[model samples]
Target: MSRYREIKYRTVTSFQRRIGNPILKRLPNQTLLETTGRKSGLPRKTPVGGRRIGNAFWLVSEYGEKSQYVRNIQAHPQVRVRIKGRWHAGTAHPMPQDDARARLKTLPRLNSAAVRAVGTNLLTVRVDLTN
Candidate 1:
């Protein structure tokens, strides 16, 4: 990462963490990704944008392994996602070979746009819904 991109990433993510996320997580329509904290062993939820197709939900992480939730999934693949107000248990997998940009285009526009805007290391994550 260049100096400029690194600074930008820190600034943008800090703003989102302190402001955007808290509000977004409260919205009824927002989908929440729940991952167990790798160290604390507590559930942590983050607002996310994705689509549910059949028995799976697809999402692209803007920061790949650098993301806290992704790191959590690395330690524990089992996760829970809140979609349309219902919770579904699933296993999260990071698909390094997947085309993250192309995958984003297939997701909800608002989220895809945000992900495109702030994401540096785009990564694909697929969760197999156990329902």
Candidate 2:
């Protein structure tokens, strides 16, 4: 990655980790993706923006594999998503081949706009809800 992109990634992710995530995840109505920590053997919930379609929930990972939640998903595909204050079990799949930019168009507008503006290595993730 270019130096600029690397710096941007660090800056954005640092803010999200330290400030944004803590506040957002606490919101009662926030959409959340829960994944088992890759090394900690604990649950990690992240505030996300996405729309549930059919038996699946779709989201774009702005940081792709570098994102902690994505790494956790790689370690454990089984996950839970809290959508509209209800939790649903699912399997997380990171689609590197999918066109994340196009997929974003189909998601929540505010989030899509933010993702487009800040994302560097965008990736699409699908959760097949089982409950």
Candidate 3:
């Protein structure tokens, strides 16, 4: 990971530890997802924007496929989510190629200039949650 990203992750982790919540409070239509480590079984949480499509909740990965969180979700789909302060335990379902591409079209592009400045790929991943 880039120094900037490492620092950001540390800062966020500190914030979550001290405040018991993420700094990015209201994510408009987003939700808070808490996943357990597949091995350690420790809880890890992050805020993600999502849309309700029919009965399922769709979440786009703004960080990319290589993210540790993404890998964790892939290892174990069972997850706990907080939407508007209400928490629910569910399973994560990675969107299929076609569905991911379709959902990616709806997401905003990464700020190339900012990414260049930070030296990291600002790609996001797309996932679905089923309760």
Cα-based TM-score, every candidate: 0.98, 0.98, 0.58
Worst 10 residues of 3 by lDDT: 111-120
Which has the better lDDT: candidate 1, or candidate 3?
1
Best by TM-score: 2
Q: Is candidate 1 or candidate 2 better by TM-score?
A: 2
Predicted model with the maximum lDDT: 2
Q: Per-prediction count of colliding residue pairs?
A: 0, 0, 2
Put down candidate 3 lDDT per residue, 1-131, tens digits, no spaces: 77778787566546545673445545543467777887888988776656555545566553455456677888888887776677776777665353444464454344233323432333434344454
Which pairs of residues clash in candidate 1, taking residues 3 or more apart in a chain or in different chains? none
> TM-score ranking from best to worst?
2, 1, 3
List per-prediction Cα lDDT, in the order shown.
0.94, 0.96, 0.58
Greater TM-score among 1 and 3 belongs to 1
True-structure RMSD for candidate 3: 5.5
lDDT of 2 by residue, 12-74 (tens): 999999999999999999999999999999999999999899999999999999899999999
